[model samples]
Target: MNENFKLLNKKIKILHLIQHMKIGGGQKALTNIISSTSISFEHVVVSTFNQYESELNKLNSSFIDCEKKNILKIIREEAPDIIHYHWWPGFKMIPKNKIPHNCGIIVTVQDPTPVEDIQADIYISGSNFINLFQKHIDGKKRIVIKSYIDVREFTLKKKKNTEIIIGRHSTIYKNKIPENYIKTLLDFSLKAKFIIAGDGESKIIEKLNLEIIKNNAQNKIEIWPGEKIKEMLSICDIFLYITPDDSFEGFANVISEAMVAGIPVIAENKGGNSEQIIHGKTGFLCTGYNEARDFCQLLIEDRILRLKMGGNSKKRGLTFDHTIMGKQYDQIYTNLVKLNNKEKQ
Candidate 1:
């Protein structure tokens, strides 16, 4: 091995414990950090549910499937310098009193609410908005680590069609499509296409379809299966979001993806969306149905404005790329390890 590689291998090891390896917000972020920091540190991910093998299989790091491996046994064997937990549920995999006293613990909370069940050496909030409602558990320094968006994954393709394509994606059950928003979309049925992409109760989809039929907008609306998010985004000219009041996005990943794809977003002004979207620049965050409708109309009417905002959105989205987050995590890991070593001495 080269000297640099030897040095990297000898550096403090990090064990990342996550709830699952499924393709979701938390899992994606964990995989991105692992991919970004692979060359600089020794890393391993221990997941409770390994039903879906992640794309991270291509990486050099190891993954311990909870089905076959005992997590506490692996922790003792590896003697990792730092243990980072991704989501709250991942904590259940660890036996309460089994953690090594010398190991530095870091828990990244993806929820908008303060975590009360577990204590850690360091805490990371999933977003700046989420940080507002959270408390510093264990009185540790709280760091806000926003979700990283991979700008390269989304191609910047300008809107080509006269028919404006508005897109949205999420777990449909958690985020309800406002009835008034649906009515507003139907109002432009002649000139626009509303594309909804996500997994939801079949009955909910059927009900929405019936509503579209009642408005004579059957041809203007398409509800896609959740798997086709990338394809839907590629064709969309603008992203429209209509979420319920109670819904809180730790960080709206799909909104960032749309922005990075060179599409201006019109999202609900609630939750962490305000942090992701710069109103009147990247996109518009609207408070009411009228504001959202007006924003959509503005984007539809002015192609130049759409292009400008889309470009700004991409620029803003690039700042949230994983490479930047990886470096930040590296710094935190280095400091925490150094502190732990000093305490031991």
Candidate 2:
């Protein structure tokens, strides 16, 4: 709502590039931004992987196709005021002839590697964590912009005795650590049900019969696979994420979502996660698997602490609401356009 941003109010078309719109943190961030903000500008997101067309359309997609000609044709017809790229790998495939499509490109860097070297008019990193690593390609505008959430989705909810760890089971990194979270929960002699709310883990999950152990004690671990997470997150008391050396986590939308759901989050004590949940306020942060286990134990026993932290988490969630993010990006876009015009003259 600044003067610079008002200049872009004439429905400027923006072309966004994405690897895919699957159920992942990165794609969700992109989807939320496009969906929540007021459409002051025309926008199209060309996902390389042709998934989630309906969701994209629900978010008001001007054009949702993922073909090469379709991409250029849409751009040529819309004549987008600026083409923004949020992906990395697909750029290599862009024919050199279509370089004009990207002549005024803006890319949002989700990580801190080779993506930093790519040419762009304005390079926006989702959080300072990624942008702080290396300076932008000299002279190109680089800024740290954090993703926002729909705080209305998350409010202070009373704690439920049912504890949950919201993540996948398969896919562990170096050090031969337990790759699957279901395995970790199964390893413990827990008294509460551990719900696995995502897919892939179910394949390996069935092989290990955790039900027998739960049946013996009249307690259980539930595997509710696939993406029906609204009630799961809303009712769950605790949420945890354990990963190693993941370079592409700028602002995990799940963290924002969980915060809105008023779940006390426990995550690895590194990277951009520090920006998400305030340590000991909204959530707790610890290093190593054992430390994470200890944190869960602490939350389970302390109801007052859990309720207080969950409320704080929801409060923090509102700070990142998408309206704020779009306004910030609008000003940055205006800056890029003015800079482009100044150079042209």
* TM-score of each candidate structure, all chains considered together: 0.84, 0.82
Lowest summed lDDT across 10 adjacent residues in model 1 is found at 88-97
lDDT of 2 by residue, 1-345 (tens): 556657545665677777665545566667666766556656787765545667777767754556555666666766666778775444543432455553367777666554645556667778878777547455446777787766665554544543444332212223112354445665554445665455433445454344445455224556554554665675677787666544345677767877877777888777788999789999888787788878887887788997798889878877878878877777666666667667767
Candidate 2 is scored at a TM of 0.82
Tens-place lDDT per residue, model 1, 216-282, is: 7767888888778888888888898878777777787778788888788888888888888999999
Q: Candidate 2: worst 10 consecutive residues by lDDT? A: 168-177
lDDT of each: 0.75, 0.65
Task: Report each candidate's C-alpha RMSD, comma-separated, in the order given.
Answer: 3.5, 4.2
